[model samples]
Target: MGAAAAAAGADPPPSEAAATPAREDQQHYVAAATGGVSGESCDAAAPPAGGGGADDAVEPVVIDASAVAGGAGEEEQGECGFCLFMKGGGCKDEFVAWEKCVEEAEAAGPSVDVVELCQDATAALRKCMDAHAAYYEPILRAERAMAADLESFQTEEAASHSAASALASEEGQR
Candidate 1:
């Protein structure tokens, strides 16, 4: 039988002649017939395939420093002090002053710069907030800590993703 029939373990097709190749060309013919890389490199512990392992499971990492730094009952502040000020937690009058000034500036003109037009109000609010620093400092610190933790988590996740991509690309090249 022909080499194709031998490799397939079946009779040759009717159109092709049944002729055996010389023994020297048997290895080359078999190698060509079965096209793939083969080696002893697979003896090591194989990496987890297709995310079936617990290590490959995806879970969100939540970092809430507000509960640790600030009082347990206090609300979480995504930004530093704006949420507290807007919610009338402290320095309500100063915040209101600044807000009214900003509104007036907006009402005056669409292009009015609230920062420039309401500089005095903003300064007054800042001074008031500074005077009451002891009340909100812990909350601010907690917010800053949370921000740092989030940034750190994001950076680490990005690094791990890039590493995984590099590994995948290397395997693809092989």
Candidate 2:
């Protein structure tokens, strides 16, 4: 018998061949044989299912250093009277006056009286500067500690808000 006749079982119709597993295999083979690109990295195409890009995962923190510094300095000054004075009115005026006095004394070419007056003024200004710093150091430290505490509280509050928002979103999805 011929090969096609034997396979058809004594005059079976040709359409019956398509019902066999071999036909299914051939269909799958033909479907897979179509021309297309292969073996390319998936990252160049769409991301995997349910997986987001890097930026969608975590955001960055942007710190304003100058603004932070200004806030800390203001807090320190508010806590320290000497710091406030130095920032407000005292240091510049005193330094300018001292410079003028020194200039006048030195222009006289170092006479005993001029030298003595200049030395006394210099010592007095140095002592005042030292005393000012000594008086304000504790207050500035206290203000810095308070600012740190406030910053921590704010960070915690923000984190709590983010977590709460995430929980709400998950519940909504359900």
Candidate 3:
């Protein structure tokens, strides 16, 4: 069988056997194949005589970073003042003002004035975040509880999908 069929884990039809290998420009391959190449690796031709078909092979289970416990997901963000300031971001006018301040200070190079400017910016940003936490712990706890439930659902959903992969999709339904 040709390299394409070998890569595809099947033999080509005998009628197509006389065709020449496609030129580099003419060759077609799946763009999303492993390592971004669709061609078969040197050792990945037909299986040994008695070996089972490629369809019998099980795909390796890969753990995604999003599945990591306590991972920083989009919904899980700043519980603290400084973090909220940075993550939530400010309005355009506020951003422009802060950007201007920092840019001017940076343009001045190393100096006591620049250091003071940075300190002031930090204080302002922190204050902005502290303002949002006005209601304190009770609100925070409710938010955390909701987040925990969401994380639980996501983890369970992913685990179910991974486990179900072992069975044929139709078999599972039956």
Candidate 4:
């Protein structure tokens, strides 16, 4: 069933997921390098060091993607399940765009970069990710909670198993 579902293109296959970040980056760079994608460079999209690093990452020039001016197709796709933006009523289009960039990056072959390659796609993906910054807090919180829970569960389970073994050994000694 899993293979059938995958063959049907219900979701991205694992091979696409395993592509290196550099390839993903090159796709974005290509988008940025192209002058038509809103005049913003990828360099301007980079996070700073402690001085509004993330928010200041963009020297933003907003492109009119037809969704903002209002569209029917985007309104139907719905929120990202993995993002806190679903709860906050924020832009889900950012994730959709990011996913598209990832797909393109993965599909692309051996694209080496010079300063001259397009960076708009990468910048756009970055901007989309940054815009959904609300997800960061919740995801980070969950990871910490899960880690702590796993540690506690493992310790308690080990102790219980050891105690049972000791009891069995004493009984056998009788």
lDDT of 3 by residue, 29-58 (tens): 211121222332211211111111223222
Query: Can you give the lDDT of residue 112 in candidate 4?
Result: 32
Kindly report the root-mean-square deviation of model 3 from the true structure over all alpha carbons: 26.5
Candidate 4 per-residue lDDT over residues 1-174, each given as its tens digit: 665334333222232222222433323323333223232121122221111123422222222223322456543222222321222223345445544444455446458332123356445534544454432323333445666888899999999999999999999999
Error of 1 at 32 (Å): 72
User: What is the clash count for each candidate, in the order shown?
Assistant: 0, 0, 0, 12
| Model 1 lowest lDDT segment of ten | 42-51
Per-candidate TM vs. native? 0.32, 0.27, 0.23, 0.32
Give the CA lDDT, 0 to 100, for residue 105 in model 3: 73
Who wins the TM-score comparison? 4
RMSD of 2: 38.3
Badly placed stretches (over 4 Å) of model 1 are 1-90, 97-131
Q: Which stretches of candidate 2 lie over 4 Å from their true place?
A: 1-131
Clashing pairs in 2: none
Best by lDDT: 1
Error of 4 at 136 (Å): 1.2
Name every residue pair that clashes in candidate 1: none
User: Judged by TM-score relative to the true structure, which candidate is superior, 3 or 4?
Assistant: 4
Worst 10 residues of 4 by lDDT: 43-52
